[model samples]
Target: MVIPTTSISTDSLTSLASPSPTLDFYDSPEPAFSFLVQRIDSLLDCSSAQKTHHQRRLPSLTSFVRQVYVKCRLSPAILVIALIYIQRLQHELPIDSKGDYDTPHKVFLAAIILACKFNDDSKSRVQSIYQCVSVVYTNIDVNEMERSFLGVVNYDLYVDIKQLCQFIQEHPTLELNWED
Candidate 1:
């Protein structure tokens, strides 16, 4: 499938050049695009040779993320926000050392879902796409994951401009794009 060219329009809930006063998911020259993908893929920690038994059943993390990004037409800001959610959730949730729960994939999924819901204007369309994609997850499973994530994070979904700028500056690659 052809991925539409990304653009930026902060006039809505989103931007193309820099982090606006609020969060937005518009197409812009995403110099940070590849960096964002790499960052999320690294978080999965499941390379082809290192795939856990469960991971083997799913698409490569990079593949899964790209599919979601392209199909959903997600903006770079949404991508950044998803990473933030993942980081926050990692601290709030009690990850199971035994490897039963808190799988990176699940956390990634929930973060993306939350980000999409929070950032997208045509939420119903976005929601419909999520229900269909995201690999083997059913709608109910998606709902539970989202609910669990919100509970753990105390429903803190806000991504302000300063916070976004801070996160970008912290991630050198992203900062480069924002500065350019």
Candidate 2:
């Protein structure tokens, strides 16, 4: 059996080409972009009308995290270490106080040591960091702080630096690029 095939010429196809009505998607009666623009413009207009509106602004995630740490009576450095340690251990450490929580000298030391281990920097040494903490907290005894640091930290000195580096790499918002 023989099959017959029909093919249209390129010239004929070119001749049929004609400009049609150009309808922009954004020009629709209820365009999404237009709604967004209107909402933004409304917000801009209302922004100047009331001071309370500015106060209603949501706290940033970082600020919220810091607030959580503050509530736990943890210094910013300790909070940072806690976060890193938690990530490393894949578990939350008990916040039980063996003694008075008022002077968390041991916790401070532990945090500094943890940070140093994870960071692998000599700048955050236990003694120097403790000294800095002592200066900042004038009432606190440096010897006591050092003792508490040693006591709390004990043998758990090893920290996974690789994990910390990986976490930092993944979270660009952390801004961990510190220059010496």
Q: For this target, which candidate reaches the highest lDDT against the unseen true structure?
A: 1
Task: Return the lDDT, model 2, position 88.
Answer: 32
* CA lDDT, every model vs. true structure: 0.60, 0.33
Report the C-alpha lDDT of model 1 over 1-65, residue by residue, as the tens digit. Answer: 32333543333445233434433333332435555555544443332453454355666555566
Scored against the true structure, residue 113 in model 2 reaches a CA lDDT of 45
Q: Candidate 2 residues 85-180, lDDT tens each?
A: 434322222333233322222333444445444433444343445454442333255445544454544534343334434554564443333111
lDDT of 1 at 104: 49
Candidate 2 accuracy as lDDT = 0.33
TM-scores of the candidates are: 0.68, 0.31
Which residue pairs overlap in candidate 1's backbone? 6-27, 7-27, 7-28, 8-27, 8-28, 10-14, 13-24, 14-24
RMSD of each: 5.5, 25.8
